[model samples]
Target chain A: MITFDKTTKTYDGGVTAVKGVDFTVEKGEIVVLLGPSGCGKTTLLRMVNRLESISDGKIMIDGEDSMSLDSIELRRKIGYVIQSNGLFPNMTIEENVMIVPDLLGWSKKDKKERFKKLMNMISMDSEKFGKRYPHELSGGQQQRIGVIRALAADPPVMLMDEPFGALDPIIREKIQDEFLQIQKEVKKTILFVSHDIDEAIRMADKIVLLRGGELMQYDTPSEMLVRPKSEFVREFFGKDRAIKSLSLHTIRELQDIIGLAEFDEGITDTITINVNHDLRNTLSMLLNQEADQVIVVDDEGNKLGAITIDIVQKYLHFEIKAKPTLVEKG
Target chain B: MDKWLKFLEINAPRIFDLTIEHAILVGAAILVALLIGVPLGIYLTTNDYLAETVLQIASVMLTIPSIALFGVMIPIFSIVNLGIGFVPAFVALVLYAQLPIIRNTYTAIRNVDPEMRDAAIGLGMKPIQRLFRVEIPNAFPVIMAGIRTAVVINIGIGVIAAYIGAGGLGVLITQGITRGDNYLIITGSVAVAILAMIADGFLMWIQKRYTPKSIAN
Candidate 1:
């Protein structure tokens, strides 16, 4: 766990970039620091690795005072990804991903194994891309190398500062989904910083909302959507709170009410969605197909349940309570 | 044109010796300047105040006329009992070469993408590691360009070194001027120009060869 106890960052000019902020990131959780520019979100994320010094209070990592640890050693244990991919231009993609491991003195055989595993994790052909330099790859591919480079040493904590900010919308969505899949397997404690509300909602296990170096709200995405503490956060979530909330839920969340709808043979032609599909996509499918309900299937294409518009509406209206179980299981 | 060819044929042996001397003078001076200037340039990047002072001094050196700088070097070398001959000429040429070499080194290192440095540091690379692995490799092309400029300029200024008794292609030109022989002067001037072109082409090839293929674009 990483704990911030009244951490404050005051610049030489007496401008407090992060003011007495406190929070704890549980292991295997992805906590996002969401805010506008100059709100200290980046500062807070950087402070954890000692890239930005804190003027007051303390940061404890795994219950040890972080300041007492060697800054280099501290940083080595925490993976860091930045807005620009930051791959060394002179090095090839394989060498880039293996940098941290190489530094940590992993044997040649071990480095080779990790290199193949990381490339395969991203579905990149290790043999073909391994020899190619960062400039030779597209922006999204470079970012994948950037992300995997951080994971090269198997560091328990990962810090990403707008890792996908530079990509086009389609590439960004694709990478975000790919990253989510990787996160499920790695389960590293992650502190992600992003200004995009939709990105924050989609990736964060918990969102720490800040404005002008002050914490406005610290809650799960669903809770924040349902009960915004201040007008700033509510406004920040934008005007379409209900529709946005649908994205926070998946079709499987209402599985308890699934058996109520009969899996009739006549309705076999209805649109089929995976159980893990988000409620927003399910609703869009319903409207597009002009059907009141849709068949949901498991990964094996076995019909698991039927999701109706009535359940989606009830869940959106808070008529049904969603117990916060692990979403990665699906 | 016939006179020039006749002059080259008659003075071929002497011209050959003088050409060797010219190459040695320029080559040695550039070698010394690179040894001193490259590190100084790298050092300047880390120390802003020193960079400003050193670069200012180098720029000032460039503004002094080559003849005047050679004259200045004569007295300094004579005081150290190494007067005239190749020592003073070599010293003058080295001083002249410093501006381009140092400036290029400083600018190349400074121009390295700041984001790359941040990424390097964030990944726990030591200051020295980042300098060698990231900064130097990226700055290499510009640094090589600087060296090329310095060498070419040194070649031109090296002709003036003959006045200080350093034998070179300039010897033919000086002798031709004294004897009022335009053909001898033309031969010396043409040889020096050709030599400069050859050196520039060689360094350009080296620069292209050494630049990483990924960043060649």
Candidate 2:
């Protein structure tokens, strides 16, 4: 849905914050701009909304050059979220969420309806919290409001700059899961900026890695993890890349590749995990509980079979060895 | 004590009139200062050099003794043939008020959480729309505070305006000093003090009433 054609940003004094970066974000896919600080990930994202003016080349959104449209008009058509969850402190929750709609001149009734729907999406009761200000909510709730506020106008595109970066780790993880759940219902074409490697791996359909304003690599999280294009890419993912890659594969993928081990009913000291749980968590669970096996259940709590440490290792071996060749051949 | 009370009872009417005059002088100065300082402050936020220059000038102006400022205003306004009374006093008060109003306004608007400004820009708010709806509203409490400071300071200084024949409580004090009547001086000083407190209290109410509830605490 969005294509960056050698997009570049040069500030005064001959300093380039974003160098000739080229990438494409597919429709309804989350493309995360992943880089360390000063790598220009944020500068690139801001260029899309013309917040940071593009100095050279172009960014095409929905086949139209971004610069060709009025900056304000282009921005209104896109959702924007920042790390601070920038809800207007002066406005109540309802007014803050309905900002874009108000800007669009939507009727009061229409704005109220959209506000209700957005509050509902975050599972926040509109009547209970509508008149409350941004400070009244917790960090996570405020971030949720920030997200829905962007989604308020139902813009086709979204630019999120570490929307959950401010929350504590536990809350951050929970909100990240909640955001992903929301994304499933509203599949926006998103350009996400994140310095957190784990967040990019978990949320992005594609990761655009950068270093010092230069594009390091752009590929699926798994591809980038498994077959890094450069030494920096490998280092960026870190020494536990094989283990980190486990997060991208689910229990279902492992079951399909190599069937689960038999369930021993006599093994009373065991735990159960859902079938949809990622292999990384499953591995951690196995190690943490030190149980012989874990009973794996489907959505309806039907026990499919049991899985063990040995089975996870075997699947990991199969995945690491088998996928690279397939990717190469493809 | 009997002499003080009797003096207060006798001059109560005159004191009331002077208090009203004192209030009008301060009020008009603050109102005009708001009109000038607020916009100038907002404008300064957009221009760095101008903000520095204007704030520095205001600071220097603030350091001038209110009496000295009133003194300077005499000659400046006299060139127009009407320097002695209300005009010089009014202009002097406005000049004195600028430091607080402009400084607070410039700082408040300039310091509005940058994240908020970025969000406003990102959400596609027009420049004017952002200024009115986001920047100014968020900056309200501080701007009101500046006005309050200006009002309180001007009320005290408004007493000085009577020296130039502007007709405020200062007349009692100045004339009493000339004639050696401590009763008039005491009444004038106490009256001015009460007026400052009441005016500040009124402004405090306004600041609270209009400050965005979200950040009021």
Per-model TM values vs. the true structure? 0.93, 0.96
Best by TM-score: 2
Chain A TM-scores of each predicted structure, in the order given, are: 0.90, 0.96
Give the worst 10-residue stretch by lDDT in candidate 2 chain A. Answer: A321-330
Measured with C-alpha atoms, the lDDT of residue B86 in candidate 2 is 92
Docking class of 1: medium
Where does candidate 2 chain B have its weakest 10-residue lDDT segment?
Answer: B66-75
Model 2's TM-score against the true structure = 0.96
Candidate 1 regions exceeding 4 Å error are A258-269, A288-293, A304-308, A320-330, B1-6
lDDT tens digits by residue: candidate 2, A186-297? 9999999999999999999999999999999999999998888887898888878788889998999989989998899888887789999999999999988767669999
Model 1, A1-106: lDDT tens digits are 7898999999999999999998999999999999999999999999999989989999998899989998888888999999998888888888889888877889
